[model samples]
Target: MAEKLESIELALFERLIDVGKLLERRADRATREHTGIKYTQYEVLIRLRNAGGEIRMTELANKLVSTPSALTYQVSQLEKAALVERVVAPGDDRGVLARITPAGRQLLREVSQAQNDMIRDAAVAPLDREQVEAAYAALGALQRHLRGEETGGILPDQAPPEDTH
Candidate 1:
């Protein structure tokens, strides 16, 4: 029983990693073909758009699962392309905010349409609605678990907080 359980656990974990890799590869290819921007850049634009068109740079980095320096570089590149702008945070000389511009919003609309078409046609066409819902539930639970949410399975990454002495 123990060996069988361990085998199932390993298989599930490995398959999860593979699924992520495959999805990323497909997203990158789709972005390049449809939007001419890297997948990560489109993701940043979407994040900014969702955050009311502007957010603090540190917050953006956290949302993007990226480092501050890396996000700064990406934002600088986007600024050069006239897609985004950075302003010093109000009354905070050390803080910066990244705002998507008109051009950025337009780009997002185009890219989002393209991505929607691709996902609808290429990704979701074959899946039954119930299958898709189940997959989403499983993945969402995993995400919550990793973030230490009470709703999930409390995986290793969700270790209990240490009490201050």
Candidate 2:
């Protein structure tokens, strides 16, 4: 049983790495051709949008799987495009928050739809919806486990964080 479990773990790790590489390649190609923004930037916009348009820079960085400096660079670019603005956090002058502008929301809507369509066409269309749901559930459980939470239940307030990798 121990050997079998190790084999399963190794295979899962290999498949996950392969999937990450393939998705990154495909997403980069699609975004370059259609959105004019990198996949990671779009992910940042989505994260901001989902957080009700603004969130602390550190919080956003955590959600984005990015470093503060890297996120700062991305946010700077977005700010120049008028897609996002950085504001000193109220009451905490030292903290910064990234706010998605109306333009950012509009762009997110357009690009998100296109990106979803592209992903569905290229990936989801090949999978049974039930299979996809099963995968989502299993991955969510794994995510919670990896985060050091107990297995089997995710608290209402402990919903999985968005993966912007």
Best by lDDT: 2
Worst 10 residues of 1 by lDDT: 156-165
Question: Could you report the Cα RMSD, in angstroms, for every candidate shown?
Answer: 9.5, 6.1
Overlapping backbone residue pairs in candidate 2 total 0
How many residue pairs collide in each prediction?
0, 0
TM-score of each: 0.80, 0.83
Question: Model 1: clashing residue pairs?
Answer: none
What is the TM-score of candidate 2? 0.83
Q: What lDDT score is found at residue 45 in candidate 2? A: 79
**C-alpha lDDT score of every prediction, in listed order:** 0.75, 0.77
User: After best superposition, candidate 2 residue 75: deviation in angstroms?
Assistant: 0.8
